[model samples]
Target chain A: MIDTVAGLAADPSGSTAQDVVLRAENVHVEYDGERPTRAVRGVSFELRRGEVLGIAGESGCGKSTLAYAVTRMMKPPAQLTGGSVVFRDREGRETDLLALEGEELRAFRWNRLSMVFQSAMNALNPVTTVGRQFDDIYGAHRPEMTKSERAERTKALLEMVGIDAGRADGYPHELSGGMRQRVVIAMALALEPDVVIMDEPTTALDVVVQREILDEIERLREELGFSVIFITHDLGLLLEISDRLAVMYAGEIVEYAPAERLTDARHPYTQGLLRSFPDLVGERRELRGIPGSPPDLRGEVVGCAFADRCEYAFEPCRAVTPHLLDIAREGAAGWRAACHLNDPEHRSSVSDAEGPQS
Target chain B: MTALEVRDLVVEYAQSRGKPFRAVEKLSFTLEAGRTLALVGESGSGKSSVLKALSRLVTPAGGQILLGGRDKVPAKEYRRAVQMVFQDPFASLNPSHSVDHHLRRPLLATGRARRGTEADTAVAELLRQVNLTPAADVARKRPHELSGGQRQRVAIARALAPAPDVLLADEPVSMLDVSIRLEILNLLDDLKRQRDLALLYVTHDLATARHFSSDIMVMYRGQVVERGPSDEVILNPKHPYTQLLAAAAPRTGATRAEVRAARQVRAAARSARDAERRETVVGDGCRFRPRCPFAMDVCATRPPEAALGGGHRVLCWLQSEGKAAA
Candidate 1:
């Protein structure tokens, strides 16, 4: 019984004049096979211009799938079942991303949008030199550029990511894991795309190296003024780098809010995820593991997906799916959560202690 | 009593030419019953080498591993007392073999249980201990049938089948999801307390190490840079490497300014000379000197271990000189 219309109208972050770079409407992604799995279910969100939007979830929660769908990078077995992805340019020109095919799609990629895959260190060609990889990208997207110009751009890109430009002559195996990942980042930014979708870009790297790479990305984003969709299972990292955060649970965005305001998350799933990892600088408390496993996506989800595991789950949670609605709370301007407990009518049944404090 | 004590343990890998590359150098630590020690380091930092050496998976080139204050223990007894739970559970467990077969093998080999009913009972108990409920169903399934967390639990259960005094866990929960990781860690903690087993938890993540262990040892380039109580090392790190790791780790409630400052500090610490010095300098000087922000002329030579009181020790010239520069 959440008020969707009122909630949508009260979005402080979203306005008519404000620029939204990308918008996904009712996105649905499914893995097609003998047992078809609905990976992403009715996910909708708008990526603001020049802002880092972090999508945080567990491995099977479909964060990566959503990223792929938005960028139109879904391959066989993984198909975008339903959704319209609209990419809006600076001049208010809107293009349907899902409609782009073949040559148009190829041109759209790297020119307007780029992606840094997970374990992207392995994404580099082991046999080819780092410069050759950059050459390939430039060759495909900007064939008009001369060979010497490509080389110069390659060197500049390498230098931008804090790697020695001379090392571009070496193969991927010659460089360290961190350096290889940086090369991937440099290549992703080579075309200067308006949007970059990074899927757990730093997951394989060590903490120190991870920090350096993220810092480099933060610096580059500031300079280039490009929007980013950063997807990872690590909430702490998402909180640190992202301006806005989306918490996905069982193929849907359970909670969406500004990063700073996520500390007071209204969704029970979000709270559980936050409590699962030990804080580096807080009072040591026993980490509470969410009791049950994630729902099997192959089966039909009758109600709220997290209902089985949620401590605050009530009758409505088990009977009806909750829609993502803006929850009024202090210091949480545009905060929204998909939970029955957040609804005004459902708040009375639940104890005040369990309800989110405004 | 000290269940296992490794004194100046050194492990080397033979290269094609010149000197054999030392994977672990003069690494020493003691594991007492009922206590957990976390070995924290990045990749290629010789953390895994230490684990391999202790479990006798890889023979040590130098130094000795004493068991119960004795230089040597019988091979059979040693196998029963020391067991290792590997990092990758998927690869560690045989895919073709059932969970029952995996658990029973250790128990039978260690003479913990005889054939038939005895082995079955032991397997069931082990499964329950690791929190894999409905033991009969889980025991019948293969490794592939279980989730990542369940597979890790089965691996732990198999390791515990022999009722080992010391457990060597190498990045146990790193492969699992964040929600399931805590369950495994909690299970390990419970096992240690219940059985009084000495546990050596190895991981590159400092945050989890601080939460699960009582003592923390930081390793860098096959050497112990810092060793102390987990709280002391995590909160008030003395070594530059440990400080860098602390600063680099993404923590809850970390501010943008703090993250930015840490990045700047790390950038300043990565000297061009350090990269070059790594290739040429060998056993003569402190391994961390080149990258150390507080490095001095004295750091060119190996610095003696400095006692920082309350079981905390740091290997740095500045620390030895009481400068507290870093």
Candidate 2:
């Protein structure tokens, strides 16, 4: 089906030419269990070629779930409850990723889309040499390539990322944290995928190493012209690397805007995130962390998920769950936030701290 | 009087097969009892090595660790007055042990608080000091039951159990996610102020270091590159390494795309450096000459002399030459 779509889309006379590489509509993901959790709710986004979109949230915000859902990596108990993640292939064919089965899904895993995870170091086989690992990844994806050809290609890729080709013989343990991360990145880039998803790839490394690895990712994206969906809890790091930012509360994106808007957000939750983030530059102010922890995800949340902790939450905020609404009062164009404070009709019900609590 | 003074500290590991690798070398600093001194450096730059030396976790080969103006203090004495809070609160706390066990053991081990109901009350008070409310609720819970922030509070409470006069926090907030890091840092600052305790904050983050400490020591390759008041050193870094670190910080106003581009260039250069494995001659006038942006021919001979002033010290030959010219 994808092949047919691609063939038709590639035809000059065909009317289906779209610039978007990936589009996920109304995505809902649920974990499988005797008592399962709904990890993602109504998540939607579009990835254009060469654009880096960052998913920012605390743990359990379903950011990672969204990544899995898009890549069709959802395992047992984790089911895509609803929505379509449409991927436009090189030939401009659109296919729903969730609908793919077995070989069709596996075919796109590294070639069209790839993901680098937090524990990517553990992803490498300790017994095998780095060269062998690269060979295996390339070999598994492209069995048509001979051994010597694969080796040459591997060396070229390693050199592209500034990694010494000599270290290809080193085992996983022999390399440092930064080097291992680079190797994982190199493997992700071997297929030259159009879309790359990274889930907290540098969370374990020191700040220096974190900076180094993010730099490498940014470089690869620039050189390869691939779109990136980078996930992490560090707002500072996200702000430093992402072109656009998505602020997720619970299982929903509360706000989506250019990086500047996030630095000065209109949404109350986003405001809290900006204030809570420790600035590497600027005078040291008393760091006021969010007063309360994230709401329990095991159960349902009513009204605003952040109301209990928000200093500015009001009555309407507690009684109703605000959907993404555009407000003209703020200078943010196309910048939307999910808060009743911005709705004129809802403002009457909201009054200070007494608005709502759970 | 200085709360603690370390002179010519050198930490070396002696493995069976390999030659001893000196992790920290000729590192020296002093902190006043009420002032906070931050040791800032990248990984493998010996900030943690300095902390381990103070805690007696790793013995120094050629330095004297002085506490309260006295050299060579006993480990137990140091333990009572110099408690350390490790980076990871979750990993630091034993999973099986309840919060009560975590706090009470340290109190009893140091003989600060006795067993039974009295120990429990003291534990409650310590928890209160770190702002853990309804302390009893957390007392019965294991580490996994609490949030990362709450577990860190417990760890801080446990460290305070020994009633330490000096606190050594090594990357205390680094392991924590950014949202909660400030709370922990503020707690450390407030505690240090109230207790008049000398603090040795060891970390690679200059932003947090500037926020938490009064004095700053920028280290590289086990040597002190620049040392001064935290504000002066961070805002007006004289050392090339310090300048590089300050430049590397992610600024809020800078767009991610721009920072990413800049970082890509830096990583490429660093990778090239790593491949070379350039050696720095120990007896050279300037150890950082190879990586230094402004290396002069004079840096090949004698090691740089220390330029000391009011709570500021630097060992760069540039500063020395500037002083002599003036």
Candidate 3:
């Protein structure tokens, strides 16, 4: 249960490098049209087995596009310009996701890499019963399984999400929003996929409902031992459930750290995002949101995408694009930030900054 | 000054079968000028129903909505004094229409501004107020051309075109980005203060509700479980449901044990929530009793309105029992 707040179970130092279930290296996705948009720009991350890696960013920050690209779910016009999405099986066989096509690609998804969309109602067929949906998955994947096995599996999955198995007979509209979301989750886990990519799965639900769903996801991830990539704009919520976080801005990861250390991030965008949410337990103070809008990525960006909004942006920030540099944070390996402030030459004492501490 | 007063407001929908569904049951509240009241609830909690009723989109089955301390007011007058900013800016705005037309129509319809330079200046001023600079550039652009944040600003601008005394914003920033959400909320807060508008903010997010609103009313299945000053209600909740909401909200720097404790209580409640559908008829009992951790025998019937001073009130049997002692 401590894993929900601080991951004692998901401590990566205990895990081996071989446990990397999925790795994306220098991933790039572009939407080619009249006005071309580079949705993802050289984003890279590793999803270790049994670890919850949260991709935190706002809308159109390319987090979703990155997810779709990594999973090889990109449709026409939106193509993966460059990247290697390597999926390493438990038996130590690496499969290139971008190379897989047709039957192999269709079989790969839900068998290994599954996705839970933002809206469950949209994901689920309104016309079909929830039980039939599970049966359909079983029919498609586990064709050798008996009818009774499929039925029993459906019952167990429904019960796993704390929903009554009897409700499987009901349509998506018959169940509540939370129940529908839970059903979608249950279906996603039907095949017991190695990695589940949930993109804002609980955004539309209420606070209580979202919390319950998150808790359930954490529980199921522990019980089943599967890695998860949870994406959301809610930095506060992400801080709670994630073992490690990747904060993205305008298609690039600005900061990567253990969930606990994100509040003390070196990136101005991450800090601004952390401050954006009003704490439910803290002293009430007025929050001044970050001013200015994100730069249009349709055209080439010369420097930092967040430079226009950064309070600490200086001369070098506008002229040069900051690369992701390793920062020092105790007990957290791979703590990095893409900011000029991370460099000593660019470091200057600001009223809010915690200057250069290893 | 009381800008709007609502007493025993009951909103019902005609069901195909059985009795009419009571979406809101005897809800009572007063909105003061230059103050924000947040109605916090999940789906089926009737926060939307209340918004619909307040905006005159749906007539209440019962109760009186007294604007400026009077129940009787002209329809045009009521409309001019009360305006709404919808949840989805994309759907709220017409795709074919420009930003100028949206703001201009409201101003002209309400007699806030006339056609020609008067209307043009009013539209530009409205756009400027929302921080959409070089007003002419933004005014000419259609809704599709603008970003989500900019479109929301235009929606706010459109809402302000009539210069209403009350602004009903329904999840105005939920659809927006994290960084942009605060910008819109801060803009709304500034506009509220500047215009001295009575703002009724309805949303599912507790953190924003507590921060943006002076008062908060936590609703559960068409009934308010708790109502109080924002900080008091969130910081030290008297009701079980409100307590759950406060604890369930994800916050930075939360202790593991605290989360574990919340999770343990949630196990039983999750099952209860799954088993129980939100029935139209709540039957003269505490609405939160189904999910309440500390539900007693008295909760089966009706709980007393236990007042915890400072305008904080709870409709829980536990509060009623511990009132004299605590």
Candidate 4:
């Protein structure tokens, strides 16, 4: 079904056809139990080489689960039920990430893809020195490398993140929260992967430290030329960093568009989210939060997941599900939204009854 | 009316092997009724300490906390007049207890209710005030049964149970989802207007502070570096720290080029000065001087406060001298 939506023209940023790095197609993940929850439902997106693609959503919206599933990191009780994750290497070799098993999966991970987990404090080993932790990653992957080579790489990685190499001998407890996060980033870059997935990497840090870490990541991405899949609940940060964004709501991608075009989003849910945040620089307007909680994923959703909270929800939104389709607009061609309001035939009828709520 | 006045307040934390660390140093601010004063800073910047001091969670090392211009107030009266809403709704609420029980305890303890029937009515009213509709149905649910936004509403309802004149919310909505945070903020704003309650909202995010509060104070380390009306302070920040914070907060309409420019400005500013690494300092000079982009020889000594009109004041040598010359 997504074949119609696939092979859309490259973004005007000059991303050629060969720049596609990772493509996730119709992926579904479910948390198995007595009443299983479908965490990620038919989510699909493609990431280009050296491009920053952001996944924005609230907590429990399955954004994080989708990130874990793409990296093949989902543990027991949470299993990927369907779809494929295809990764293209530097030499144009394609590998189905979900099909790999055992040692093949191990070799693919960290070499082609790496992830920086949320809460950087918990990501590091507290019992061992930071140097040893870096050594552990290199040892597992590059077993034949000499200890001196590992130490040299560790020192270089530390310096790259602006941490002194001398601090590598200290335990995780000795470093501040920001430094620990830098260490984790260094570890992720140890294998020099083609893509790095960071899940709320700076959520625990202060705003200043968060800015510093973000700056470092941007600098590293530019120099190292690795694509980034940054996931966070902060749409503000996403708009600043992401070249393209996919807004997730209740286990589904509601809107996919260029980051700059998000300000004029077509989806009501996306518009609501944009209006929900308080502005730092602009004139103050009364922030109207999207009322009501997200739908329970335990039960199957029939229509639009955001129907209850959306003021612009119409009849088709309650009876039939809308598929993600291209809704071309000036300066934002190839923009897709899973909303009936964008449908030409449906919009003509509904637009007369209701104006845009946002 | 001035609901609360904190004068030269100091908060200290005892270290395991060294002298007591001063978390908040001579911080002074006034909160007027029906208005909000936001204390904005990063983690470990003593914003939470001010809230803790107001709630009596931490004893002040020195200075007076006056109520309505009076230096002394009865202990029970003080506790009743000032209430606190914590950051984490999940941890602040009792998992096992129903929402009714949570609100009832505060009401009964404050002598707002006498019997079961009265307590029940008060609990229902509290829930209704926080906009948790169908109060009876929500009252029977446990904290675990509620969503993050609903749990926070219950926490706010419990805080209002004491009929407090002042509310201290320490990052009340930071742990909540992005979509739900504004609802809680709007709720607090509504309650402040309806009840004429003075609110002290503490958070690290400056954007939300400007949205919810009328007056804003930017803190660094343990001292107020700049303070003024929210719009004035945010729009025309006199202090470098305030400028950095404003630029660092991601804006919704900001383009990637603008963001990159802001980041470049922050990076240039950060690299201009050597950031101090020491945890504790004992100097009278500006604590932020180590990382200040405009640091001068005069910053090595203590700087006097400069009034910038419109109730905006900045503690910087350059500003003071500029004002003196003018």
Q: Which lDDT tens digits does candidate 2 get at residues B1-326?
A: 58888889999989788678788988878877778888888777888888888888888889888888888777688779888899889799999999999999989999987789889899999989899889899789999998888888899888889888888888898777556777888888898888888888888878878887888998887888899988888888877778778877767777555665677678666755654343756564666777766566766765465655665666676777553331
Query: Which residue pairs clash in candidate 2?
Result: A32-A77, A240-B256, A315-A350, A315-A355, B285-B302
lDDT of 1 by residue, B90-131 (tens): 899999999999999989988999999999989999999888
- Candidate 3 per-residue C-alpha lDDT over A1-358 given as tens digits, one digit per residue, 9 for 90 to 100: 1111132223345665479899887888899988789889988888899989999987889999999998888898899998688999899899999899999998999999899999988999999899999999988999998989988999999999988889889899998899999999999999999999999999999887888899999889989999999999988888888888999999988888888777787788888888889888788898866777788889999888898988778777888888777676667677778888886656653433443332
Docking class of 3: medium
lDDT against the true structure, per candidate, is 0.87, 0.79, 0.87, 0.88
Root-mean-square deviation of each candidate, in angstroms? 2.2, 5.0, 4.2, 2.1
Predicted complex 3: DockQ: 0.69
Q: Could you list the iRMS of every candidate?
A: 1.7, 2.2, 1.6, 1.4
User: What are the per-residue Cα lDDT tens digits for candidate 4 across B96-124?
Assistant: 89998999998989999987898888888
Deviation in Å, model 3, residue B237 alpha carbon: 0.7
Off by over 4 Å in 1: A1-10, A14-18, A356-358, B257-283, B322-326
Q: State which candidate, 3 or 4, has the greater DockQ.
A: 4
Quote the lDDT for A241 in model 4. 89
* Per-model TM-score of chain B: 0.94, 0.90, 0.94, 0.94
Top-lDDT candidate index: 4
Model 2 DockQ class:
medium
- DockQ values for all predictions? 0.68, 0.55, 0.69, 0.75
Please give, for residues A16-71, the per-residue lDDT of candidate 1 as tens digits.
53478888777899999888999999887778889999999998999999998988
